[model samples]
Target: MKSVMIKNKYWDIAADIYYPPGFSEDKKYAAIISAHPIGSCKEQTSGEVYGAALAEAGFVVIAFDASYQGASGGEPRYIEDPTQRVEDFRVVTDYLMTLPYVDENRIGVLGICGGGGYAINASMTERRIKAVGTITGANYGRLMREGFSGFDPISAMEAMAAQRTAEVRGEQLRVDDLLPSSPEEARSLGLVETDLMGATEYYRSDRGRKPNGVNRSMFSHQAAAVGWDAFHLAEVLLTQPLLVVVGDKVGAFGAYRDGCEIIGRAASKNKKLVELQGWSHYDLYDKPEPVGMALEKLIPFYKENL
Candidate 1:
């Protein structure tokens, strides 16, 4: 496995292109572009593990930092913009297409967490991607417009509007601190309260924790809160194969299930909703056993379909 830098116009989005050692460059291989979750770099859990696993499976797996985060080139570092994130996937796909060893026709995408929503969004608009999958996926627009299950749209609007006003006033918008820096802090952040399950372990522990990430930033909340509708064209995935992977023990899993149901209903071909037994939302990020299970399901799916 080797880490390489690929240029996307003005931005040099840092990425790692992993392949089996001594892998031939002459063979045209299936390609996969993986998107990491919000605030996570390409080195994080799901992206790092899956990128290596899929490479060993004889596919060219490339995991890149989303714009404005990590080593990727973009303005307002660590910001989250749903629409631009979706476009980042398309740009990555285009970059892959230009690779000498990548078979453009067999290109697929895997979105981890919020990246999953961006993947779905890209799949609907970008026809080049033949297969799509998500692990502990999120619908960015859905979450922003509606908080959790009984999300208050009015509050979401107020928050976004306030942020927009701050932007217009030339005030430095404060990035909300949602991620915990340590185990003790996780409890205070309400990330792991009482029986909240694996979120605390995921974000605070070494499992999913990163030293440099911001843990919280509402870069897209304002845009998504008012007029953004992520699933508006999800029905367009009817012709493409879709895979939804989620942990069974967290609130995110339910959202994954609901989104899967909607896409499954709209999809005309292969579609699967996988619930990893006893797994929690954060467990899927870097944990080997669970991540391996996801790759096992994903590789075969893309091989057969893409």
Candidate 2:
């Protein structure tokens, strides 16, 4: 395995390349680019685990910090603009194509959690992405537009409009704290016990916690409510093969179903949806038992499609 710096005009994305043992530069190999979820870094979750695994599986896998988060370059810390995040995928793909050992034609992508939406959005514009796979995915646009659906619509719209106004005025808008600051706050935020149980685990537990990250921020420029839709171009994404993987848990499963229903409605052919039984959202993020299950479906999908 080796590390390389991939730079572009807008940002410099740091990537860790895992080459199969005894890899040769003379022979081109298929490549896989893995993207981390929102508010998370490459090394903090399942993104790193599967990146190393897939690299050992013979594909040249690269895991990168998205443009603004982790070790990558971006400003206005913790801001989550949907458009910029999707572009980060393109930048990663652009960098990968320049490698001599990578078969640009066979390149594929795997996005975890919110990254899945970006991956799908990227595929809409990037034909170079031959295949795509997502784990415990979420559709940021739908989540923002609908606010967990059946929950509240008026509040969601007001919050979005407010954030948009703030962004336009260059005012720092509070999107969300990375996590609840205290036990009382956690309960107040409703993150402690809800349908998103896995979220509490990921943000609060050592399984995927980080010291540098904060639960809330003044301006998450990419607030689902304020920023551009991650799936705006999804209607035209059928040209590339897609694999959508989800856990059995309600929160994650519901999002997966929504994504599939939207893309499947748009795609012409070559799409798959797999639900991992007995697994919750956080399980697929890092737990070996459940992640292994998700990967089983993913490996075959790419092998056949890519």
TM-score versus the correct structure, for each prediction: 0.88, 0.85
lDDT of 2 by residue, 1-306 (tens): 666777856668777787877799999988888887777777755346888777767788888776666677776566666777777778888888788988889999888877887787788878899998888777766665554423565565566667768777987656566455444556677765443556666767666677633444434343453445655646665568878888766663255566566456546377778888877767787788987887788888888877
- Count clashes in each candidate, considering only residues at least 3 apart in sequence or on different chains: 1, 11
lDDT of 2 at 160: 61
lDDT of 2: 0.71
Range of the 10 consecutive residues with the lowest summed lDDT in candidate 2: 213-222
lDDT of 1 by residue, 1-306 (tens): 666666766777778888855588898888888888766778775456888888878788889887777778876666677777877887888888888888889988888877787887788878889988888887766776555324677766676678778877997766666545577776666655421335556666766666644456754345553456556656655458888888776574345555565466645467888888887666687777888888889989978977
Show where candidate 2 strays beyond 4 Å: 148-175, 181-195, 211-227
Highest TM-score among the candidates is held by which one? 1
| CA lDDT for candidate 1 | 0.72
